[model samples]
Target chain A: MTARFAVGDRVRVDDRTPPGHIRTPWYIRGKSGVVADMVGAFADPEDSARGGDGLPERPLYRVRFRQTVAWPDYAGDGRDTVDIEIFEHWLEPESG
Target chain B: MSTNVDDHDHDHARTFVPDEEDSLGQYAIVEMAVRELLIEKGVFSADEFRQGLEVFDKAGPHLGARAVARAWTDPAYKESLLSDGSAAVKEFGVDMNLTELYVVENTPRVHNVIVCTLCSCYPKPLLGAPPDWYKSRNYRSRMVREPRAVLAEFGTTLPDGVEVRVHDSTATMRYMVLPMRPEGTADLTREQLEALVNRDAMIGVTVVPAP
Candidate 1:
């Protein structure tokens, strides 16, 4: 239930694809972003969807990524960004 | 030959019923079944469910507009709204219940737009059900990728220096945009300001101009 990543910490979304309903978007997987805010914790939908208790809520964060990182062909201002809510388990400390 | 007056069988081609698509989808049917089962099981009474529906039925963009007007006229209130969205909205009688409300401000340098790339996770307590376009697959996929182009489609062309911030409501938190007040409205009353704030403006698809 504790948040490993704090605000301003750099993190990258894990690029794993599992079966059943997922809260993480496919586009954001493997992409890097900065933790913008700690979103507390909630039952991980990945488990909750399967009729599990979803106990020990997973910490979530609002990760902000440059729009360019999401779409390299993006034609808008380089500073444009996209903020998405991601669960802690889906994020890993940025390697580089 | 028409047994019923409304049928109008006199026409040569009846057109196979105008809408074969009226039937509820699989998930919708499942939801209904689950709801009935819960009510029957005493998880909640039917009247309680009806009360919940009434709350949702009473929602619309005007509730959000009222909050926007208050924020526009009062700097202190604006700070509260920007800091804790759900708490500030509660003052105006918007209770999001378990769902958290995240308010993003649109400033001169930054323009904010909201979308649920996964599904339609809007701030329904403040703005009611999302528009059809908001729930469309095209919007869910493209808004985060080409927000500028999407804004252009909605006739919202931001300045070159402005940063377009796209918020993907992928998780539990619902989002609503607090658009920058248009110019020349300095003399307008609070009610007038609320009248000027529309659904699209709060959705961040379009910016309202002063009349």
Candidate 2:
């Protein structure tokens, strides 16, 4: 399947906190970042955790966020960044 | 040789043969029973399990060191490694088919660090099991929040000008840091460079020391 988001596309992580195992970390929820790379498609880890077939794989992207933007109290250099591999379902196009 | 024989005799004299009844916990018993049931049901043979264990036993950080050393010596290999890490490692005969591998390079301007905040998902095929600190709740929680402080605890103090990029291995992708080759090592052979790469350096906990 083709990737929904291409590299350099600005996307925001969905803020919903659904129950069960999730790949997106709490710190990145609702944060916006540009897609660094499309890491290809894979089984949905959230479904796999519950013993499901995890079929119809979803594309995963490495989202890069500035450290200062992720954490208000980040003490490191402003240029520092954090990259998290997030499934396509957890991301949404950033709105103007 | 005489001392070895005496030690063997001393071990044989110990009569503390503990059976199932003498065990303090039932976890091992349950594990063995489940394993036997699985084997009997043809899920996997006992021999296959033993072979898997042997493969795991043979994998360690030394394999990752070899990959790093090769990348340092070969510019073309380093480019391929940075682009397709999983495939590049195959040149060194390391197979990591379970998950996609990404090689993040460390330069003079940027230093890379890796962590699994959700769980202890590591590049076991290349670097063996994750170190105790890598799997600890403290490291998982604090690394992304305060990386400089956490790295300092590991005795890695980066310069203020260097940008620290922390990669969280949250999905099926695993990361390995291709640390910068130390100074005064240009004359060293690949084998010599391999000796300098350690488990912590690949994990980004510490930098490779100059030889």
TM-score of 1: 0.87
Docking class of 2: high
In candidate 2, position B133 carries an lDDT of 87
Best by DockQ: 2
True contacts kept of 1: 0.96
TM-score of each: 0.87, 0.91
Model 1 off-target regions past 4 Å?
B1-41
Spell out the clash pairs found in candidate 1: none
**Per-residue alpha-carbon lDDT of candidate 1 for residues A16-65, written as tens digits (9 for 90 to 100):** 99899898999989999999998679888888889997777999899999
Looking at model 2 chain B, report the run of 10 residues with the lowest lDDT sum. Answer: B13-22
Clashing pairs in 2: none
Write candidate 2's Cα lDDT for B159-190 as tens digits: 86999999999998889999999999999999
lDDT tens readout by residue for model 1, B1-211: 5656567564544566454557889998898899999999999999999999999998999999998999999999899888888999998788998789888899999899999988799999989999999999999888888898899999999987999989999887988889899999999999999999999998899987787
Clashes of 1: 0
lDDT score at residue B99, model 2, on the 0-100 scale: 95
